[model samples]
Target: MVEEKSDRKKTNTIIFDASKKEPFNINEGYKILHRRLKNSWKVGANRDAIRQEILRTCDVFVLAGPRMKLQDSEIEALKEFVSGGGRLLVMLGDGGEKRFQTNVNTVLEEYGIMVNSDAVVRNVYHKYFHPKEAFINNGVLNRALLECAGKRVDSAQDKRNSQGLSLVYPYGATLNVSKSSVALLGTGTACFPLQRPICALNQRQNSGRIVVLGSCHMLSDLYIDKEENNKIQDIIFQLLTREDIKLNQIDAQDPDITDYTTVPDIGYLADRPFGCLEESEELPSDYMKLFELNLFKLDNVTLPAVLESYEELEIKHEPLGLIRPHFESPFPPLTPAVFPPQFRALKDPGLELFDLDEEFSSQMERLAQLTNKCTDEDLEYFILEAGEILGVFQNSSVKRQATAVLDHIFTQVCEFKKLNQD
Candidate 1:
């Protein structure tokens, strides 16, 4: 059953599994790709174990490089979620269990897809990084949908299309789709000079759909925007924004959790060891029972105070002549009151600053592109420049606003650092 959240309108909700020990998560490189999709749908992580109630709330479910096997109940929940017209995107890598130990094949077998245990390598047209960086030169997007996208199918448009477009498959496994499945992208005689299926889509029941990709890193933050990997983004866009799928809010409670709480205590131990096993002695069961009985008695009994007369204690306050020193803050001082017009006024400089605006726009565009693949040092350098730009502005309020934006980006860097630590 679907229900709307009181805070916002109901849209498609794509839940990425975090409970299954996935290598990729929102905290990592997938942050920006998800940020780009914020306008169309609600994308978030599922921290709790998968259950029927949780699946009912999600429009699309993703299991990417899961390192742990799903419980029996979770498997049933997933099966029911798909049978009830939900969409599932399963991503597996070439090394499979050897790398992540996530045996997703058990779930894929039920859907008529098999994840090969071997990695797909291309010695001929591989990326400079490694030979395993395979690229698909003849990927077929839903051919009919390509025409439906627009009238003029230019090179840029063709790259977005699923039909006859070469896409970067990267380090992934080759797939084995069933007879009813449609091959989205083929190996194209690149990996071992033998064609194989890399991505497959299957239609189950009336509205159910399942897309299996052999590569988990294809849509990751690092590779999603690389070479031909943008095609994967196009595929994701089509999947989440499709008009045929009906989206609903999940409102079911997790059955695994309960109200009752169990508190463990050292009192439950029969004996305590000091030096070695021979030196340790076991407590008498009767004495332990008596001790527990006393514990309960103390909960209900409050002993009287030793003093007969109750008196309030007073604390003496001593004023120490503490020296206060004036220290300069790192941030610039605010001068909004001195120049109120610059801070509060909204005036369009218009074409007067067109040349400057064009230059600023180009710089911003370049910064955005660099943000996707830039190193930590590059981000720090740009942030320093951004701070300098803010300092150049005469208006204190404008500088404050720009600082906020820079701070937000800095938080993203901090999150990246924390993820790396984990």
Candidate 2:
């Protein structure tokens, strides 16, 4: 059977991927990934925010891009929300798109941050998210790079490996931050130039608490595995579940009232990690506010999930662990045979552009299989057509009118077939 995502209700991780469409079928596309990255409590009750709920329920949020670029209303809402104390979880995508980053960075710059998209930047100092078997500790990660690397490294690089600096663009960009801002991790091998830094931080002098992370792979469907073992996950855990900042640390003396907003009836919200506090007065009604909520595990051990009959998905002894299909039981034509053969040709060093990596080809082969509905042998030819298109473009050295056009076409086609299955 051709692989396709199902729209089933499951605990929320309602994603906002810059690369995919709205309301992704997280139950299947990202369910396993979520479980791996999540704390014990979020597993059972699908209490996650899909779209609106994501903004509403989260204390601090994480986002992957090539999908959700910033806009004016979104910026205004995010700023007010964070200034009111909204925690943000952010990452950078391919720094190869100027037009997309231009508008996105506009929203971010007002926050004291900026995004740069250009040239493929790569360097030895930069660490990739390799598989478990490939995990390694290469060097002492200057905490600055760690922000982009992750709180948890699947493998630690040897600290002795040291002393290197390089610049490469078109890879992933950096958040050129304002003076009030500081890098949580140290500088690394390559970073895209962000023309405006303080802008992404909402022009705030203290947006460090805002938590800006670079590197978008952390949450992608293909990259979530990296997050499973990322050192960044620890940072996320600390940021999200703990709602208290020591009350005694700030200057509480009778001063600086103009710059600060006050929460009137603050009482004991919790005692362990510190205390959760809120303005005893009514808060704004905006779904995009920055109010924080320290989530406790979904202690109600049961949750709902849909499953293909051949596979039995048992949960943590919870009755809610069953999936309801859109129309039928045992997803029809359940055979792996229909899936496409993900073939990878050995690289020909003779041709740089012709060197299609196994990863790229694997993705295209599967995407093409699904997009053709795995039924149209004629349209199925586009798989080869697309690869040839890349080959031809590289050979002729012609600039494109638009980037990602072919990607858009292919992805839309795949999505069409995925949703159209009846």
Show where candidate 1 strays beyond 4 Å. Answer: 1-11, 141-163, 240-422
Per-model TM values vs. the true structure: 0.51, 0.37
Q: To one decimal, what is the Cα RMSD in angstroms of model 2 from the true structure?
A: 37.7
Off by over 4 Å in 2: 1-33, 37-54, 66-71, 96-102, 124-171, 186-208, 224-229, 240-422
Poorest stretch of ten by lDDT in candidate 2: 248-257
lDDT per prediction?
0.64, 0.40
Best by TM-score: 1
Provide C-alpha RMSD values for all models, in order.
Answer: 30.6, 37.7
For candidate 1, give the lDDT of residue 359.
61
Q: How much lDDT does candidate 2 score?
A: 0.40
Give one digit per residue, the lDDT tens place, for model 2 in 336-381: 6686787888875674554445345665664555566545654435
Tens digits of lDDT, candidate 1, 335-370: 676743556677866655345553666655655644
Against the correct fold, how does model 2 do in TM-score?
0.37
